[model samples]
Target: MELIVLDTAEAIASRAADAIEALLASKPNAILGTATGSSPLPLYDELTRRYEAGRISFAQVEGFMLDEYVGLPEGHPERYATFMERNLRSRVDMRPGSLHGPDALSEDLQAACDAYEAAMAAAGYCDLQILGIGADGHIGFNEPGGPLDSTTHIDELTEQTRRDNARFFDGDIDAVPTRCITQGLGTIMKARKLVLIATGENKAEAVAHLVEGEIDPRWPATVMQNHPDALVLVDPAAASLLRQRH
Candidate 1:
């Protein structure tokens, strides 16, 4: 694992954009694993700018969302698909077959998870995966005690997670879906590269626990420490807990 501390969130986002741009440049059909939420918003914005400027295009690129809220309506404003479509997909031009995600309302929820895993496997696995750290140190909704080798599957959001995500649903904790389908740590580890973006002081403890603490399911992100190619892009506020050599 490599730690990169940027001056601000904007800088971290720009660096992430640069990484994606380089990957796309090397392989137009690169499979990109995407994450939703505030951590990656700036990276998406930067990608939009590049797409508009013709510096980069998604025509041949493939996208796979990292997780989704199960039991939510197809068009639920809080669904990960809706979040991706509105925030990122709407801004780019991509082949119809390039974007894929787990269905929130599939008749067979387990089948949905299996299908998503199959789709990812068919896509040649992700060339690079973007990630966000939950306040409780979870990644892609793989809460504490989740199996490191598990594949895509249903997960029950913890109370801390529900409270953290309540802001998106107008502060209604009850509105937060109790279940989610997330890519497993083992699946994420398969990516050729992994980039985790985090900002703000709110994430400091989680970041520290993940980077400096033991590798345990208690803090899902800590598993990244064992990945061959994983990067943690953080701002000063988010890296405050680190004990710097200098």
Candidate 2:
């Protein structure tokens, strides 16, 4: 695991965007695994700027979303699908190929999960995965549990998570779905590179736990410790609990 502590949220996002651009430059058609959250908004903004300037193009790039609200409609304003489209897809020039996530109302949920996994497998797997850590240490909605699932599947959102995400629902916690479809930790581990973006004081504890503590599912982000190349990009507030810096 590698750590980068930036002075501010903007700096963190700028540096993360530079790293992603470098990766994309090295592999134009890279399969990028993406997450939707406030932490990654700046990174997406930077990417959009570069694309608009003709310095980068997503024409051949492929991507898979990390998670989605299971009960939300495809066009639901609060859905991950809507988030990505507004924040990313609409800003970039992507090919006709799909950017997949879970089907909220599929007849067979398990089959939908399997198909998502299969689509990723057929895409030659993700080369770089962008992530955001939940305050409770969940990654892609894999909350504290007995064992992390190894495939795409539905997850029951903990109250802590629903509360944290309630802002997206106009402070209406009830509007937040109780469940989500998230990529498994095992699936995330397959990516050649992992970039986790966490900002704000709210995330400090979870960042410290995952980066400094022992490997445990109690803090699912801790599993990133095992990834071949995991990089954490955090603002000073988020890195407040780091015992030591490198």
Candidate 3:
């Protein structure tokens, strides 16, 4: 595991983008695992800039989302698919057929989960996965106490997670979905490389726990400690609670 603390969010994005650029250069059709939320917005923006400037191209790349809220209407602006379209796919040249997310509205959700896992296996595991740590130390909706070695499955969102996402639903906590389908810790661990980004004071504790705490299921992000290549990028505010610096 490697920790990189940057003075500003832009620096963090730049460093992370450079890593992605190198990966794409090595393998044009690399599979990318992406996470939603504010933490990765800057990184996406940087990637967009690179694509527009002809420095990079996602035309041959394939992408996968970490999770999707259950029961969100197809066109809901807050749905994870829509979020990705607005923030990434629509802006880049990635093939429409190559990006995938778990079926959030499938009638047979268990089948959907199984199919999602199969789809990922067919595309080959993610070469590089971008992640964002929740304030409660969750990742990909895998909340506290979730199975450390679980696979693709449905998850009940914790009250804290719903509350944290309420802002996206116009501050209506009731509008946030209480359940979601997320790739499990075991699924995420299969990625060849992992890059986690965190910013702001709100994430300080979680960042600390991920970087310095014991490897326990209570803090899902801590499982990255067992990964062969994991990189954590954080702004000063997010790194405040860490006992040491890079």
Give the candidate number with the greatest TM-score: 3
Model 2 scores a C-alpha lDDT of: 0.87
Reference-based TM-score of each model: 0.97, 0.97, 0.99
**Where does the lowest 10-residue lDDT sum fall in candidate 3?**
95-104
Give the runs in model 2 whose Cα sits over 4 Å from its true position. none
lDDT of 3 by residue, 1-246 (tens): 999999988999999999999999999999999999988999999999999999999999999999999989997999999999989999999988678999989999999999999998888889999999999999999999989998999999999999999999999999999999999999999999999999999999999999999998889999999999999999889989888876
What tens-digit string does per-residue lDDT give for candidate 1 at 19-125? 89999999998999999988999999999999999999899888999999987888888789888888888789976646788876888989999999999998888
Q: Candidate 2, residues 134-222: lDDT per residue as tens digits?
A: 99999898888837546788789999999999998999999999988888888888889999999999999999998999988899999
Q: What is the lDDT of residue 169 in candidate 1?
A: 91
Which candidate ranks first by lDDT, i.e. highest?
Answer: 3
Q: Evaluate model 3: give its lDDT.
A: 0.94
Which model is ahead, 1 or 3, in terms of lDDT? 3
Q: Model 3 compared with the native: what TM-score?
A: 0.99
Residue pairs with clashing backbones, model 1: none
Please identify model 1 stretches exceeding 4 Å from their true place: none
Q: Which residue ranges in model 3 land beyond 4 Å of their true spot?
A: none
Candidates' C-alpha lDDT: 0.90, 0.87, 0.94
**Sequence-dependent TM-score of model 2:** 0.97
